[model samples]
Target chain A: MLTLAQQLWIGLTNGMVFALIALGYTMVYGILELINFAHGDLFMLASFLALTLVGLLGLATASGPVVVVGLLGVVLACAIFAALINRTVDRVVYRPLRNAPKLAPLVSAIGVSFVFQNLGLFWGGLPLDVMGGGLAAAAPKSFPDLIPSTNLLGDGAAFRITAKDLVVIGSSLCVMVALWLFVTRSRLGKAMRATAQNPLAARLMGIDVDRVISATFLIGGALAGFAAVIYGLYVNTIKFQDGYQNGLYAFTAAVLGGIGNIPGAVVGGLVIGIVRALSDQYIGAQWQQAVVFGMLIALLVFRPQGLLGANVREKV
Target chain B: MLRVEQARAGYGAVEVLRGISLTVDEGEIVTLIGANGAGKTTTLHTLSGLVQLTGGRITFLGENIAGVPAHELVRRGLVHAPEGRKIFSRLTVLENLEMGAYTRRDPDGIARDLARVFELFPILAERRRQAGGTLSGGEQQMLAVGRAMMARPRLLLLDEPSLGLAPLIVARIFEVIRELSKSGVTILLVEQNARMALRLAHRGYVMETGAILLADAASALLENETVRAAYLGE
Candidate 1:
């Protein structure tokens, strides 16, 4: 039987991963009030790009220091790539339909999600060595075990803490703290919060609403990109369908925390992660997803504003 | 400094501003007085570029700006303190005031204006850290007007500033409007309180349906028998 500490550790690490993606969902929802369904596929495509970069740079066999530098390069490149793509998608797909019926952009987001999935499928078929030599597009690709998984707590400890897990949790914490400071302290961040509260009022104050929205997509996408890299490293595997599963979990976290609330997303993600870990160990692996979603539905029904959300009436 | 000629606009297919024309010269309080559904708010929205003009020429500071975006208009010093006092309710009073200066770059000028706004409404200064929504309706109206003033507008548009407030609050709001006008800010005031509006304005236009039915000096409009009966609630 696993110790309680081990279960908590596993859950905390997994929760951090979900938190990264959840931030993207919550930020976009906060600004535009539109769920960017395509976000998951975006993260999937970013992982594929990261794999391609790893192969191109031949970093798989490089020395330790070189590998570290190359990994940093991959994270930065993927972040910029994802941020630009998200901004373009917003400009082309979302901006025109902004004033249309609310359902219009949502439908467009679903369509974009499908498009991104197909793109991921196509990317997996490219003749890249990192993608299992592109032999089968539908096959799950194995990400090289770049980070050593030696137990940091010594060989016989009941709780196993690895460097990979530490890196994943540490990096996520850094990003979250940075984001908190940015949203609370920066001028543009304040403008974004204002825009989220009232677009008309922000515009009246001479804030460029379009620019702010674009910045939101950019920041959200960058977080997804960062999460994609961490996920690839932690799981040692990538699949086209992983985006759908992971994205669903992140979306659930956002809703559980309070759809538009930032801190709420983080708390919701951790809660979901803990629930999933506990359910997998105590209940059954097959029932974990159901339990997580079931908890979400129950919480939503009882506290519609979410755990941390204040009960503000929806503006007419 | 601002002129609208034969302006036509509306929501979708229904025209709300039908060939309405008016002008406000530098340093004048131009009031548009009318009853409900007279397109007074629509006129102000069009001027602020919130509504697109299907047919019209809007010349502000000698530049044709009919199709410019609302934020761009605000940057060019056309500030509107809208009908509903649309303050950023989630933000603090100080943050709301800071947002007013979003387009401006000079910190010293902003500080000076902040001080001036505080002098004009000391209550706002007292509640600087308070969220705007927590304030009473009267205080919110003051914050809205104070926010607009932070933009250092070349022409300020005040739409129904006294709406849904007590008579004492209405009087206080009008006093600020008069004070702002005297301080050389060109204003386009839209109000249902025709008597108070005309009393404060140097010039006034009586609008009916979507067009201006009469235009003259505020004193002349106040004296007109039809104006007194229809709008002034005689």
Candidate 2:
């Protein structure tokens, strides 16, 4: 049996990833009330970008400061790439349907998701060394082990924590904290909140509502990029289809908390991660989804507005 | 300071404001009084750029503002305190006031306006840290007016300031309107309560079925037999 402490450590690291992706989902929903289904596929494409960069730069075998600098560069490039793609999708697909019935943009988002998935499939087939010579397009690609896996607390520790785990958790925490501060302290952040609450009033206050929406997409896509790099490094293997499963998990986390509440997404992600870890240990790996979803169904029955959602009647 | 010449606008195909025209000179309080569906609210909305004009023209301070967007109109000192007091319910009172000055870069001027808002509505100052939704109806209306004040508007468009409020609260709101007009803000007000509106305005326009029936000085309209029979409880 795995020790409780070990399981908790594993759960927390996994939870951080879910939290990052969930933030993307929640932020977009808060402003536009549209679920950008393509967001997950965007994350998947970003991971593929990270992998290609790693191959092109030949950083897989590098050591010391070169690895840190190369990783930072890869992350920055992927973030910019994803942010632009997300913004473009909004402008082309979602912006036109701003005043139409909500269903139109939602369906467009689903279509965009499929397009992104196909792009990911095509990307995986490219002749890249990091993608295992692109022999099988559908097969999971092995990510290079750039971060050493030595136990940070020495080899004899019962509750072991690796350098890789520390990097994933530490960097995610820093990013999430920075995001929290930005939303609470900055002028644009307050404008975002105001826009979310009332767009007409925001417009009357001389806020350019469209500009704020674009900024939201940019921030959300950047987060997905950050998550993509960390997810690749931590898991060390990624498939073109990884986005669907992980996106569903993050979306579930966002809904389980309040869909529009920022901190709620984080809490929901942690709960999901911990439950999955415990279920894997006690029940079985195959039953993880059943267990997590079962709990979600039961919790939602009592609180339809979600755990952190306000009690006001939802405006449909 | 503001002129609307035969303005025609509506939602989709239904023309609500059918070639309506009015004007507000500098330092004047003009009221539009009518029953529901008379296009009083629509007139204010068209002037504020919330509703698009399908025909006619609007000129503010010598520039044509017909095609200008709502936010741009606000930057040019045309502000609207909309019907139903559409305050940002989730934000704090202070934050709502800050949003009022979103287009202006002059911090000192904004601070001065903020202080004046607090002076006009002391309740807003005490509840500055509280969420806007928590305030009562009267307080929300005050916050709406105070929020408009934060923009330092040269021309203010107020819609239904007396809707669904206690008589005492309505009196207090109109008192502030008088004070605002006295301080040199050009005002165009729309009200369902014609008697009170005419009592407060320098001039009044009586609208019915999307057309203005009479435009005259306040006291003249108050005593006009047609106005008294249709609007005032004569």
Candidate 3:
């Protein structure tokens, strides 16, 4: 008997999470034309990093300004750590295979995904308070609810909005907007777009194409780090295996919107979120996954270029 | 000034340029004229660093630059307007021009070059907001030439600028090339149209297969019996 507004609010908050991850997927695909299957695992590892930072700083129960500063510090550290890891992975795994057959890098990406997942498993085993004192390596760990859950619209509203929800949605919006401006207005952004269109032509223009691609990975990874922090704060619990599911969802979102289109990923994520919420409410909980994927297939069959993808064929 | 001595290069297992040697003095239009598959395009590609030189040397402005990357070559004012008008299709004409000045950091110089490019091709200025791919073939060629001009190139390598255009468009393109040479930019012109190329060039080289068969003054090549018979189609 939930109202439509309640469903929409729930969908929006969840969609914001998917959108953040989806942006990473789309950005990398736009630049490299590779799926970057390891992105989800990168996000998962980032969350683990955030948890470790929370414990190391002992800021779980801190309040007010201290909590704000600690959270900011965690976000900064995770962003840098993820960006570096992404850049290194590009240099070590992807760059060498840049001229190989397209399928080679894709296979390498899948292998990298497995490596990241295993790393997450090992990271979860470290003795830490935030990870429940590392009780079991494979167990899901609870993230401290550093964000207050107080209702922002007072206690009397028919549909409530929590402060945590505001933080998640507001921050996701800010990141997306900043990314949009960076890609559209800046000189480096223009270089990235040019590189994507034609690498040889870009090089002839004196653009360092490899540098542009590396910058893409760095920005994508940093965004994933930001998402990791928000995801941990909102979801309250995370597992080493979480990346697979989150990544699949984000990848699906990117495909649904148009794989190389940025705005399309965001819209696709929101749509998936709303559909998941509505289906979970109206249909059986077990059928929600089936419904979401079914919709994707059906939409894809009709709009093969994706919802916002250009009709032009992808250049080799 | 640019010089290539005994240069050898090609794709895997297929040698396209063998012991090719040529030179272009400062402010000279040096044309490389040959039929299709005669290694004309490959020579330009090697000069731009798109193709690796398996053997020999390239010296530009007193520095050896045989193995420099294409991007680095451009930074040294060795700009190439490629054979095909490979403009960034998705970008607007203005953005494509902006990309041409990517290596330059001087705002005033960039601005001045941009204005000059627009003046050279007023049509490009008119279609500044249009996507590069949306332009007509003639317009795309103009944009391509204009894009190279934005780089403020000291030695501009143009590959087949008249490859597939109407007779009138080809005439217009050649006129621009003449104007560019008048502006004191060193030019290396590659063209299948031997008559037009030799007419425009101060010096001309006739390439057959992978080697230069003849190198002389443009007027001498134009009047030579073999050049007239094989290339000029007279």
| Candidate 1 stretches greater than 4 Å from native | A310-316
lDDT of 1 at B189: 96
Q: Per candidate, chain B TM-score?
A: 0.98, 0.98, 0.98
lDDT of 3 by residue, A1-316 (tens): 4477788888889998888888889888887789999999999999999999987888887777899999999999999899989999999999999989989999999999999999999988876656853569889998988898878888887778899999999989998999989987899998988887778889999999899999999998998899899999999899998888888888888899998788988998888888888888888779988998898899889987788983242242
TM-score of chain B of 1: 0.98
Docking level of model 1:
medium
Tens-digit per-residue lDDT, A220-258, candidate 2: 999999999999999988888988889988888888888
What TM-score should be assigned to candidate 2? 0.97
Q: Highest DockQ, which number?
A: 3
lDDT for each residue of candidate 2 in B1-234, tens digit (9 for 90 to 100)? 998899999999899988888889999999999889999888888888889999999999989998899999999999998899988887899999999988889999999999988998999999999999889999999999999988889999999999999999999899999999999999999998899999999999999888888999999999999999989989
lDDT of each: 0.90, 0.89, 0.90
| Residue A120 CA displacement from its true place in model 2, Å | 0.3
Q: Residues A138-228, candidate 1: write the lDDT tens digits.
A: 7898887889999998999877999999999999999999999998787899899889888888888889999999999999999999999
Interface RMSD of 3: 2.0
Write candidate 3's Cα lDDT for B1-234 as tens digits: 999999999999999998999999999999999888999999989999999999999999989998789999999999999988898887899999999999999999999988988887898999999998889888999999989988889999999999889999899889989998998999999998899999999999999999999999999999999999999878
